[model samples]
Target: MINKQYSITQAPNYWYDIMRGVEQGYSIKLTRNSEVVAMLVPAQYEQPPKQNFWQALEIFRQQVNIAELYDENVFSDVRDRCPGREVLL
Candidate 1:
């Protein structure tokens, strides 16, 4: 199993434009000589859920009826028609 942080940024299953590799993508045997505290990665946008969490979105992905809302602007019809599924609002 892959760790959540590495899976998103380093793994091929996620980001495409890889800028560089982390520590040459290798782990040296730690012998109390390693000098490090913590690490982190940059965030991505709009990517679907993976591993065990959902991606953070800026806006609502669902569709709305424009005629019913403004009567002038046409809203998208991207409705979630999941049958027999309990969805959290």
Candidate 2:
């Protein structure tokens, strides 16, 4: 990939030119006072590997042990039974 540098001040004037360069797989370095502030490059769109519902569930089950995660004794007293403060109308 070709790399080109342009000052921040020149960006507004050469906006389309810079975008065109990026579209053509060129990397554009935007600089301010000779220091690079940002880069413009071609966007890469990657689709995640698709999984069926059953396959996904299997993977989840392997990672999480349901027996240890949902012990009834551990969850029995999780919530307070007391009613909250009553508001006066």
Candidate 3:
């Protein structure tokens, strides 16, 4: 990850540019009085990894019964729908 630093005084004026950089995948370091205080990154970077289909099913099964969790007919109508592309990995 790219790292960029800015002081508290400079941060307010350049906040938007810093956020845009973060959106483009940079990690920003914000400082106060020349001392590092905080770091900013995209939400996805802080989120936990997503479970695969089977793992998610298992978790749901543990919380509820298989009858409630399983739905074979749920995606029946999705075959004709358009599948969106992945934007980020």
> Stretches of candidate 2 above 4 Å error?
45-89
* Residue 52 C-alpha lDDT in model 1: 32
**Per-residue lDDT of candidate 3, residues 1-89 (tens digit):** 75799998999899899999899888899999888899988777878889999999999878987676788999998696767787886
- Model 3 C-alpha RMSD vs. true structure (Å) is 14.2
Q: What does candidate 2's lDDT look like per residue over 1-89, in tens digits?
A: 64898999999999999999988888899999999999887875245688999999999999999887876787669988889999999
Q: lDDT for every model?
A: 0.36, 0.88, 0.87
Candidate 2 worst ten-residue window by lDDT: 40-49
Q: What are the per-model C-alpha RMSD values against the true structure? A: 16.1, 12.6, 14.2
> What's the alpha carbon RMSD for model 1?
16.1
* Most accurate candidate by lDDT: 2
Q: Candidate 3 overall Cα lDDT vs. reference?
A: 0.87
Model 3 residue runs over 4 Å out of place are 49-57, 60-89
Per-residue lDDT tens digits for candidate 1, residues 1-89, read: 11223333233543332324332342212112243333333334236655432332323224554455664334445655568768799
TM-score of each: 0.18, 0.49, 0.55
How high is the lDDT of residue 6 in model 2? 94
